[model samples]
Target: MTTVDATAIVVTHNSVSQVQDCLSALLSAGLPVRLIDNASTDGTPALVGARFPAVDLLVNDENVGFARAVNQGLAGVRTGSVLLVNPDCVLPPATARGLVEALRDRPEVGVVAPRLIARDGRVAVSAHPFESLTSVLGCQFGAALLPVPVRKLFSGRSRRRAYDACLRPGEPRTVDWVSGACLAVRTDLLLDLGGLDEGYFMYYEDEELCLRAWRRNAAVLYLPTVSATHVGGASSSPGQTWPHLYASRLRFFARHRPSTFGPVRLAVLLRALLGTALALARGLLRPGPAARRRVRAWREIYRIAAAADRTTLSQPVPMTSRSPSCT
Candidate 1:
C-alpha cells in the first residue's frame, strides 16, 4: 500500500448524515483524518467521537464558516500536504493519494483537485474561469431570458468547453481555480498563503485562494485521473446559501477585479429584482408550495442585494499584516 504524507481535513457543520461515510472512506484508506465540527447541532460531534474514535476531532463553539474552520484544522497539520475534503464528498483513497502525488511531483503546483462526480454518477463541473462582469451578466440574464439552446450559442458553449477540458483524462491541466471540495494542497504553501480568506462567510473563498496562488507563481492543477463523489448542499439549503453566494461573488470582484466590482454589484442587484419579480409572478399564477418557496427565496435575495451598496454585504474581513494569508 502506498501511503501519502498528507492529513485529510474535513470541516463539517450539521453534516451528521454524511460525515460518517466521509470519514470512513479516508480512515479506511489509512489516511490521518482530522474533522473540525463547526458547532453542529445534529449531534455530529458526538457521532464522530463514538464512531470514528481515531479521527482527530476539533469541536468549535460556534459555526465559524467553512474557510475559518478549515484553517483551524490546517493549523495543526503535521504532514507535508493537506486534503481539504468536504463532509459530503467521498474521495477514494487512491484518488486522495493521486492528488498528493500530483502536488509532490510538481513543485510549481500549489493545489491539485480531482474531477468531482455527482451522486448520480454524472461529472460535476468543478473548474471555472475567474468571475468577470460579462460572465456574471450572462449567468444572470442569459439563463432566465434565453432558451437553453440559444444560451449555449453565446456563453454556454465556451463554458462547456472549458469544463470538458477539465474532465479530460491523463495529465493534470492548469486551471484558474478548482473546487475546494476535494483538493490536496501543499501544507507549507497553504499556511504561507495564510489559508482561505475568512472575509467570505462561504463561497468564492476557494476561487480567491486559487487566484492568490497564481499571483504567487503557484499553479492550480486539475487532475481528472482521479475523481470524488460530491453530494453538494449537504449542510445548507438554497435559502441559507444564496445570499452568501451572491455576497461572496461581489467580494471576489471587489478584491481581485476592483474595476468590475461596481458593474458586478449593479448586475447582482438587477438579478435580484428580476428574480423577485419572476418568483412573485409564478407564485401568483401557480399558487403552490414550491412557488411560495421560490418567492420567499428571491425576496430574501433582493433584500440582501438592495442593501449591498450601503452595507458590508460585499466587504471582506479587514486584512492585517499576517491575516488572510492567501491574499
Candidate 2:
C-alpha cells in the first residue's frame, strides 16, 4: 500500500504475458500507471482493462516506436517524476519509491537508471559510457570474432566496466547514460529536454537522452539500490533489430560527433558488410533459419551502409520471422 510520487509509463508492443507481469508489479507497488499500446495485434488493451482497471490506457492507431510512445505517455503525466518502464521488465517492491527518493535527494541528477538483472540472473550493462567509434565497434562485432567462451568473458568484462555495472549496490554514482528500458527522471526535466529523440525508432535513444542531460548540466545517475528483471528483446528478433541498432549508432555519431562522422560511418559500414558476407556464406552452406535471417538483416544493413544519402534510409526495416533465402 506504499504509493510512490512518480507515475509509471508502460509502453507495449504485441506484449501478452510480459505486459501482465509488468502491470501487476506496478499496481502492486500502489503506483498509478499510464499504459500506451502501439497498435498491438494482440488483445493487450482489453487484457489491461480487464486485469488492471485502474490503469490509464492510451491506444495508438499504429506503432509509433518506443521513444514516441513514451513521449505520448509523458504528455499525460501529472506527477513530478516519471518512470519509463518497458513491458518486458518486472519491477521489485519499493523500486519505484526508492527511485523517486533518489531523484528528490539528488537535485543535480536528471535521470536515474536501475540495475537490470537478466532472466539468467546475470546483471546486464544497463548503464553505459558515451558511444564513441571505438566503443560502438567493440560492442557490435568484437565478440563474434573470439572463441565462444572467450567471447562471453570479453563481452561480460566490457559491459560491466563500460556501464559501471559492478558498482556497489547501495551507492549512487553519476554516470554517462542508462538504458531506457526502465529509467526514472523528473517530469519537468524530461519535458524541458523534449523527452527522447524520436529520430531513433528504438535503440540509442536512451544514450541520446542521457547525453542531452549531461549537456544541460544534469547528471545521469546509476542507482543500484533498486533493480528490475529485464527479459530483454522479447519484442524483436536479434537479426531484425541489428540494423536499427547500427543505423541509430550512425545517427548518434552524426549528431554528436560530426567532426569524425564520415570516417566512423565508413568504418561501421565496412564492418557490417563483412558481417553480412560471412552470414551469407554460412547460410548457404549450413542452411538454417537463424543463419538466413542473419544474412537478410546484414544485407539490409548493407543497403543502409552503401547509401549515397543517409536520410533516405530513415524508415526502420520491419522485423520478420520468415527467412529471405527460404522465400
List candidate 2 stretches off by more than 4 Å. 144-170, 308-327
Following a full C-alpha superposition, what root-mean-square deviation does model 1 have from the true structure?
3.8
Give the 10-residue window scoring lowest on summed lDDT in candidate 1: 318-327
Report the lDDT tens digits of candidate 2 across residue range 208-311: 88998889899998888788999988977889788888777777777787765677778777877888889988988998999989988887887776662444
lDDT of 1 at 92: 90
lDDT, candidate 1, residue 23?
A: 93
Supply the TM-score for candidate 2: 0.86
lDDT of each: 0.80, 0.78
- What's the distance in Å from true for residue 125, model 1? 1.2
Superposed model 1: Cα runs more than 4 Å off: 144-153, 156-161, 285-296, 309-327
For residues 174-211, write the lDDT of model 1, one tens digit per residue: 88888888888888888887778888878887898899
Query: How many pairs in model 2 have backbone atoms within 3 A of each other, for residues 3 or more apart or on separate chains, i.e. clashes?
Result: 0
Per-prediction TM-score to the true structure, in the order listed: 0.88, 0.86
